[model samples]
Target chain A: MADIVLDKVSKSFPDGTVAVRDVDLEIADGEFVILVGPSGCGKSTTLNMIAGLEDISSGELRIDGERVNDRAPRDRDIAMVFQSYALYPNMTVRENMAFPLRLAKLDRATIEQKVAEAAKVLELTPLLDRKPANLSGGQRQRVAMGRAIVRSPKAFLMDEPLSNLDAKLRVQMRTVVSRLQKQLGTTTVYVTHDQTEAMTLGDRVVIMRGGAVQQIGPPQELYDHPANLFVAGFIGSPSMNFLHAAVEEERLRTAVGDVPLGDRLRRELAAEDAPRELILGIRPEHFEDAGLVDEQTRGRGTEFEAPVEIVESMGSDKYVYLTVSGERASAAELEELAADVGADGFGGGAANLVTRLSAESTVAEGENRRLWFNLEKIHLFDPSNGRNLTLHEGRAAGALAS
Target chain B: MAASDTTVAAKWRWGLLDVVVVVFALVPVLWIASLSFKTTGTLTDGNFVPREWTLDNYRTIFSTNQFVRALGNSIGIALIATAVAVVLGTMAAYAVARLDFPGKKALVGVSLLIAMFPQVSLVSPLFEIERSLGLFDTWPGLILPYITFSLPLAIYTLSAFFKQIPWDLEKAAKMDGATSGQAFRRVIAPLAAPGVFTTAILVFIFCWNDFLFAISLTSTERSRTVPVALSFFTGESQFEDPTGAICAAAVVITIPIILFVLFFQRRIVSGLTSGAVKG
Candidate 1:
């Protein structure tokens, strides 16, 4: 295993198009780090730079405390699993798995033994003599994984290796990949645009946008405490509901209702340089049916009644979509995220909020229902900069405890 | 019942068209075969079939040193030219398909210009140059022009095949601890073998079928290919006709082409149409 460090890594093409900006990342030995963002976010570019497939324009990349920025991909002693699997079409599974060992000049017995071991782990023993074209999609993916693990390289680099598989197969392979990485204990850098994979697979997730690293932390930390509006909206499944609000006397005046600012938020808003206008962020799971909340527990949050536009029952919970009378949050980050998720009318005047209510709640479509949003879970962001103004100093620690 | 009736009528029309096409393509070949089996006395009979068949024409051509030497020259020159062209074309095609070097477009444009250039225009200049260089009656003279003309065809076909190969395999190979050379030999070359083989057959056919260059560049049987040698065939005396012998030689030359197409027809079809669609 190797520790990979990128010090101010950047990648720019000859035509002056910057694919990756100055980004610093340190992946620990045997750590599974995921670089994730929307398409064109340069996550794959960063992984390519680490793999030495793409040249670093103006920075140093050190693997195992050795400067390897100029090293060839083979010389770097890394293995990459491509989205296309990239298995040699002419080679059988045994030959494909044994390729790196053969290239490294391993003996025949050792190469065969290692390939056999990998095939057993990947359940590809029966397919050892089958060419890649004859394998199914999942089998091809397993072969790609088998090829990567057979070498036991310094690190593993996977670029959307599961993206080509069907959703059911993708989930199955995700567990297999995670298990393999743990069994081998190799430092792995996985690049993907799917947030679910990023959250589930990586030990630490790096959220990036526009070729820039926005945040690097645990998946739960990014989920509980997003550093900016983009991460807040990008991390969660249903995504965080955003509403435009104006700072006022001891309260934030939003279109839904007046929300009383807690002591922490009041102190943050009273700062000398605080802006009068801000964006309010709340995750969908932070809201509950007001009727289900007890009196003492109800005091910890605020309640507002709105007509439910749509209700989707997902067995465990109901996703209630509500239209509140207010201007939706308008920021470049949210707009880009809306475009990324294909959420139409996100920035329209009527703010649409999706709240996950318990299955026990009897909320019907087109009926007015009171929803209680956790006040403590609310995030306030600076509209101009997209910075989460109310982000606590120990929020990441708090996320870990919860 | 109506659908079945229409299907029957359509099958009949298609069967008629297939018969017409097969007859149109095969009649000349049958005629040539008949001529090759006919005796010299029956050569001028002007009948579709020979009254009496004989293998004497084949035996005569096989016995003559002139035909034997020309046949040997044809095989050697075409094989050598094809081997050289395919190797160079593979390298050029791979680079054109995968690499981003300056003047790539210019190289493609030049090859295209050469592919479309009229061969008749270059024959005179090439003939003069070969004479000046003392390569006038050598196999190298004919091989040179054959390679030059076939390079563009080889490059276009091979490059189209190369483009269909996922470039990611090379990167994966590198990550799998393969040097660039190793990656090409182990991963790319094997994948590209069918395409290279197909291109080799095409280039060989082009060189083997050349009559003008073989005749103009060489003055004797020393380097004269079969096509040119066929023109020199005279039945023993001025009164004799060499038509049967010529037909025998033509049929012999066509055997290899027919076998190649029959063996690799599927591969040739796929190689030609591979990159036209995204898989």
Candidate 2:
């Protein structure tokens, strides 16, 4: 219903800690945008600034073409769903949903009609008279959602609304939220630390790191082409494997094998004045069981043999962890990404490569297997600056330029 | 069968301990009730139970205008003091628990220090100040001191309760189209009602049971409360004792305190803030 624009919005504490700095974003009318980042990465701070729950120390926030940086949350007419649900414990379900309407001074009959409508949509009509304490976690979450949607505010801001639910319930509610957002067609800005939620839910995802925006694009674009070392490591599950590759003339010598640089990469490296040592990035799905690949399809990529350390059967795909002898990829951005997930052993000197093969493949633990990695899908980053040296033209310039 | 035997023995052990505690607490109260029912001649019999029962002592206190006026003053002063103290305490406590400002810790520390201060030490100074302020021997005279002394306890108890309430509820209210004041009145105040009720009861008891200020500040029957009035009771004759009348009055005042605790006991529970947020 409203378009929200954050023009160079920044937040700083009195003690001189910058929580969010110069965050520039534009959310179109009825668009669902997600701010995804690791903990302490200022995503929540940016969301709070948009909600008017926290003040922006500088810059402007405008909704519907009017600046609302100094406005109160109620004045801004935006509803929020908190991670804790935050239902009024003293009120029954109907009362909780009717709270915003009541505060807006709506007449009794109109409030009743709106609440009944919202409860019906949320499938909470049967629980209209029950208090929050009596409801299950998912039901309470629905009630929280009901409260936000009941008022038909200008926009909706959700701060990890489904994080409290169980895994199966979280997935179920994710669909519910997606369907609801489309049905209501309200502009929503959701902040979460979950990349999966960001990938699946948002129309466009904004990836943040260390109080700065790393990239902004569609989920598939970020998955296929991460802008930098941080985005490359943070976006995918069983995240992209990083290996130390030293430039030797036109060939890059890696622990897996010597990777023959294609003409496009060699031209990009020359144009960017690439370093002698580079970080090679390959996603898990890009690597396949070389034996399972056909002769014609195997010609586009190279093969490397390594002893598999572990094989996890995930029903749809087999995740094979292979260990090779090499120095692990080292960069400040990579280290921060690893520390964010509390995975200290990630990118340790063992150079463990995680590859996803077809479930039908005969790869097993403790056996040396030949894996073919797609040459066309690999990314090369400069070791000194973490910039993608092989970045294609027409990508979002904000990340590459930074 | 062996499990049933041990369960029975455990119940018996608990029952015996409960009886011992009840006896220790209730014996003095029963003795006072017995004294109140005893006739004038048997007042000094040194018996736990009265030899003969009489309603004459209750009749005497009710028939007197002095006892009635003091009782009226006691109820009015205590109720007014409790109301004012609780209202002020709730606001102060909410600010202390939720807001960040200079001197927040100092305010909490000073309030606690006042609560720990001896009441007797301040009574003389308070009496002189009340007299000069032309508030002595009046309802405000007693109510003002009671509020001043009890506000610290009220603020402390209510603030501790306020800290347990999830702040997210207030933010949710604001996001639900409520102003800050509306958010507090609709969401926070209801969540804090139990604590307020509990603090009100405590402040009421403190004001009702106060004897030093009531005796030191009031010089006439116009504003004299029950506890001070109890000391002024006289028998029908010059040489007669007023023990029976005083005991009846004591029994009368104790009834209100018992009724208060019994009525608000359920509201003094601690888990009201639960279910407001995720466990």
Candidate 3:
């Protein structure tokens, strides 16, 4: 295994479209680095440039501390798995995996041995002689992965290798890929638009947007404390809810109502915000159900009268959409504002909606006319910059609520 | 849902139109086959079917030295042209489709330039080049011209085919420890078989049917193709033979082409469709 480093790399096409801009990443040896982003975010382009399948318009790409900018793909010693799995449809799995070894001019016996070993790892021993057409999607995916890892290349590059599979198969193969990466410990650069896969698979995930690196950290680091609004919105399942709010006379003011801020929350908010207006961020799971019968937390937290617009049941968790009354929010701050709105008027601005409330406390549509929000778990951001308002000492440091 | 239903109805109407197309297109082919069995007096008849049937045309065609020599020349030229074209075309297509080169854009431009021009326009200059190289009136002369003309068509179609092939397969091959050339030969070439075969079929048909180059470049029976020899059926020294002889000669000349189409028809049609649709 070898470390792969992209030193200040940038790729701009002849059409003047910049695919990747000033990307500087150092992938640790034997670490699985996943490049995740939405389509046109240039994650795939970055991976391709490293594989030498695409020209690096400017900058150096080094594998094991050696320059590879001038090297051909074959000479670069990198294996790739494509979305189609790209198994030579004509060749048997044995031949498909053995293709590189044979190209290396290795003896037939050694090639056969290596093929057998890779087949065993991929549970493809029975499919050794089968063409790609004969294999199922999951099996084809394994072979694609096997084809890359068999020869033990310096690094493995996988570009949406499981994207073509059905949902269950994708989940099943996601585990397989994760297990295989851990077992083999090959330094790998994987590209995908799927956030779940990015979080679940990578040793470190590099979140990209608009062909620029927005944030790079461990998956949880991005999730628990995102660098900016884009990373916060892009890296999580269901995404974080954002609401526009203002600090007025030491009270959290909104069209819904005023909630008194505790000294600790006020102090944290003061440090995070040097300006008056702040964007509030909150995840769905952080909220609690303040039932009408409960006295301990009821009216004790920031209680806003909201109508339940929709309810999505996921067995362990329930997502509640709320609509607030008479609060006209800016388009950018609509989702966050919708989270605290009553269930009746909360859902029109968004499809996925502003707020996803958790199971025990989450209100069902037309069931809970008024909903409450937890003030302590609330997050604040600068509306102008989308930067989360907080002094992050580290991942352990919590964002003080104002 | 209502809009989608109308599209579905329109598609069915188009399907019916396709059936109408098949019959309309087959009329000329059926008529040609019918004429191949009739005698000369019956050939010009107002009726579609002949009053008499005979193998006299077949006998006449087989007996002619001109017909046989041209037949032999055609087989040699088409085969030679196809082999050279497929080899050169597939390799060049693979390079243009996969490899990054200093002059790749130039190579593609040149290939396109060759395919875009009308073949008749280059007949004079090609003839001059052939004469200067002492390749005039030889198998090499015809094959050279055929390659020069057919290479671009083969390359253009085959390059489109190559692009559809996932580059990952080649990269996987390289990771397996093979060089770029071997990866193409082992992984790419096998997958490209249908495309290559399709290109060869087109190249064969184009070279075989070419009349201008064959008539201009070849002077004697030694190098003349079947189309040129078949021209002699007009009978310069005597009355032209009636329908049976001419039809028989036409049928003989058409057999190889028919067989070629039959063998590679599926591959050729698929290649053409994939190229056209993807483009």
Candidate 4:
């Protein structure tokens, strides 16, 4: 296993289009790091640069403390699992797995032993004699993984490897990949646009946008403490709702109601040159039905009544889409985030808030219901720069836990 | 019930068309076969079937030096031209399909222009150039033009097939520690074999069927192919008819083509239609 480091690496095409910017990343030995972003965000390009499949326009790439920027892909001693599986169509499963070993000129007995061991681990023993064209999508994916792991390369670079499988099979193979990575402990750099995979698979997730790094942290840390407006909107599903608010004396005033600032937020605002207008960011799950909360717990948060436009019950939780009477929060970062997620537009006119409520709560569609939002969990962002004003110091200290 | 009746009538009409097509294609071949089997006395008898059946025509052609030598020249030239054209075309087509280089479109455009160019227009010039270069009447003379003319066809068909292959396999090979040459030989070349075979068959047929180039270029029996040699055949003496021997020689040259098509019909169909649809 090896630790791979990208020291301010950047990739620009001959046509002067930058795919990856000056980004520095250090992946330790045996660590699984995920590079997650929307399409055209340079996640895959970064992975390709590390694999030496793509030339780095600037900066250096180091594998196991040796500079490998100028090395060929084969000379880098790394294996990659492509999104298409990329199994050799003409070769059987055994030969596919034995390819790297054969290229390395290993003896026949050793190559056979290694392929057998890998096939067993990947549950491909029964399929060793079958060509990839005869295999199902999931089987082909396992064969791809088998091909990568059989060589026991210094690191594994995977570019959205599970994206081609059906949803259920993808979930199943996700665990399989996780188990294999843990068992082998190979330094792995995985790239995907799916946030769920990034959350469930990586020791740390790096979020990128417009060919630049937005934030890098553990999934939970990024979810709880996003660095900017783009990261806040991109990290979570039923994405974090943003509402335009104006800073008042000790509270933030929005069309829904006044949200009183906590002591920490107040102090932070007082210390910095705060902007007059701010964007209040709240996750869907951070909201609860006011009626379901006990009086003691309800005292800790702010409550407001808004007309619910739609209610989708997902068995365990209720998603209440509410239309608050206010202008929607608009910023370049929010627009880019909306476009990235393929959203038509963020709050065409009035603010639309999606709140996750307990299923037991008696909330109905088209009814005004009281919703309580956790004030302490709320994130405040400056409207002009989109920088999260409420982010605390030392928040990313726990980002690199393996 | 009415729909079923219509379907039955439609099937009957389609069967009638099939019979017409079969007759249209096989009649000339049957006529040649009949002529080859006819005795010299019945050569102009105008009977569809031979009145006097004999194997003398086949025996006469086989026994002569002219027909046999021309047959050898035809086979040698066609095979060599097919081999060279397919190899060169495969390399060019693979580069066109997989690489991003300047003038790529221009290369494809030039090949396409060559494919569409009238062959008769180049015959006179090629004739003069071959004579000046001392390539006239030799195997290399015919082989050179054959390879040149068949290259565009070979390139168009092979490149279409190459484009159908996913480029990801090459990257996977490289990541697996195989060098670029190994990647091509081990991963790409095997996948492209059927396409190459289909192109070879096409190039061979083209070279084999070209009577113009063979007759225009060769001045002697040394390099005269079967098609050109067929025109020179008159029975053993000036008075005797050569139709029977010529028909027999035509049947001999066609047998290889028929066998090739019959054996590789499925691969040829797939190779031709590979890139017309997305997988």
Number of the predicted model whose lDDT against the real structure is largest: 2
- Candidate 3 off by > 4 Å: A249-251, A259-274, A292-301, A326-364, A367-374, A395-402, B1-65, B91-141, B148-152, B233-248, B262-279
Please give, for residues A349-393, the per-residue lDDT of candidate 1 as tens digits: 788899999999999998999989877788888889998866778
Clashes of each: 0, 0, 26, 0
Predict model 4's lDDT versus the native. Answer: 0.88
Candidate 4, B195-264: lDDT as tens digits: 8888988998999999999999999999999999999998778887789999999999898888766776
Interface RMSD (Å) of candidate 1: 4.7
lDDT of 2 by residue, A209-302 (tens): 8788999998999988788888988899989999999988778899878888766666555665568899999999989999888998787788
Global Cα lDDT for candidate 3: 0.76
CAPRI quality level assigned to candidate 4 from its DockQ score: acceptable
Please provide, for model 1 over B113-152, each residue's C-alpha lDDT reduced to its tens digit, 9 standing for 90 to 100. 9999988888899889999999999999999999999999
* Candidate 2's DockQ: 0.73
| Candidate 1 stretches greater than 4 Å from native | A262-274, A344-348, A394-402, B1-15, B235-240, B259-279
lDDT of 3 by residue, B1-279 (tens): 999999999999999999889979976666766787777667778566667876666777778788888899999999999999989998899889877889999988987887888878888988899889988899998999899889999999889889877776676566556677777787778678778878888999999998999998988888999877776565424676544555566677778988998898766534221211111
List model 4 lDDT by residue over A1-402, tens digit each.
999999999999999999999999999999999999989999999999998888999999999999999999999999999998878877778888999999999999999999999999999999999877677888888888999999899999999998988899999999999999999999999999999999999999999988899988889989988898889888888889999998887888897699877676666566667787889888999899999998887876789999989999999999999999987888898887788767856356889899999999999998889999877678878878888877767352110111
Q: Best-fitting candidate, measured by DockQ?
A: 2
Task: State how far residue B199 of model 2 sits from its true place (Å).
Answer: 0.5
Estimate how well candidate 4 is docked, as a DockQ score.
0.42
